[model samples]
Target: MISTAIHCGACGARMEPGANYCSNCATGRDDPNTRALFVVDGTTGLFNDAFTGALVDHETSRAMRYKRPISVLVAMLDHSEFIANDHGPAQSADLLRELAEVLAGAVRDIDTVGYLGDRFCMVLPETDQAGAMVAADKVMHAVAAHQYAAGHGQWERITLSLGLATVNPDRMGRQDLIQSATLALMDGRSDGSNKVHLVSQMS
Candidate 1:
């Protein structure tokens, strides 16, 4: 008899003989849903947090070495918690996934998009503050115009609260850049949702 035992290609976990899937990692040879081991979010198919951080660090180092400008944008879905409570978690996840696609399509080829916790972040390479603002505006309009699944055979409009921070590699770390964008996002949220806030010049 052909043995069903195998190792998970994604996670390297052993699978029992006759088992259809790897018990440890849930990967199967024939499973169509199996994704790459890391670097991808299971839900949205965007880069995961760890991989995102690594990319940010690498980009920051390159920017510092070359003295180029870079910008990061942190965007949060407005009323996302309420959407989850009202429409259910599954629908909320669906909305997030769709939004991820929209974000991916809205950015330039050199830009990177990833999910960072409850928010989504974009890294704009070789972009200064003005260029980042233009990109942010494009994303804002795209998100606001897209229709999201609202459950029960209805669609709803979605808005994002976005924060932008630009760096010229003037002694700023990746974490500091992220934190600056996050602080701007918080300020936007405080003012009300569906708005973009730029990091203060003094920051």
Candidate 2:
């Protein structure tokens, strides 16, 4: 008969036969695949789309269960596509990385920051619409104030268009919240980027 016993992938502890995870180290047997589920974006070291969606789902459920306010912020670089077209993908990606760093610095430690494609998303737990607006304003100001180091000793300025959506008495799904924020972001872009739009104010 073939042996089924294996070692823990994380701690190298011996695992019992037919075990799904290690008893001694508590490491999962299928950790390689499991870890892939939470992989970060290689460029920015932020949560990728799959992980971001999962996080949003988890946070939304928690907020609904606990009656806590949760806010989602979606931010896009102003004229990012234009930048890519004019400056090339390398410069555009560098700008994204710099902006990601600024965003990571702007939010509270409790907040979750992730990337949804080229756009940035932040999930703020226990935050209402007002609080989210404040956070959004801070991020906008920070990005506006930051000077990115362009190539050849030249500096460049970057701006963000942000959208914020908060949980309310009417329950909303994770995707719905994201969509609302996206719509608000689009509105901000239409009004000219470097602005923050609140979904609550849209209606």
TM-score list, all predictions: 0.77, 0.76
The regions of model 2 sitting more than 4 angstroms off are: 1-38, 151-155, 169-175, 201-203
Say which candidate scores most in TM-score. Answer: 1
TM-score of candidate 1 to 2 decimals: 0.77
Pick the lDDT winner. 1
The superposed Cα distance between candidate 2 and the true structure at residue 191, in angstroms, equals 1.1
Write model 1 residue lDDT over 16-114, tens digit each, in one string.
Answer: 567564433335557626744566787887887776766667667777778788889999988877778777878778888999999999999668898
lDDT tens per residue, model 2, 84-153: 7777877767777877888999998678788888689998878888899899999999988888875213
Q: What residue pairs clash in candidate 2, if any at all?
A: none
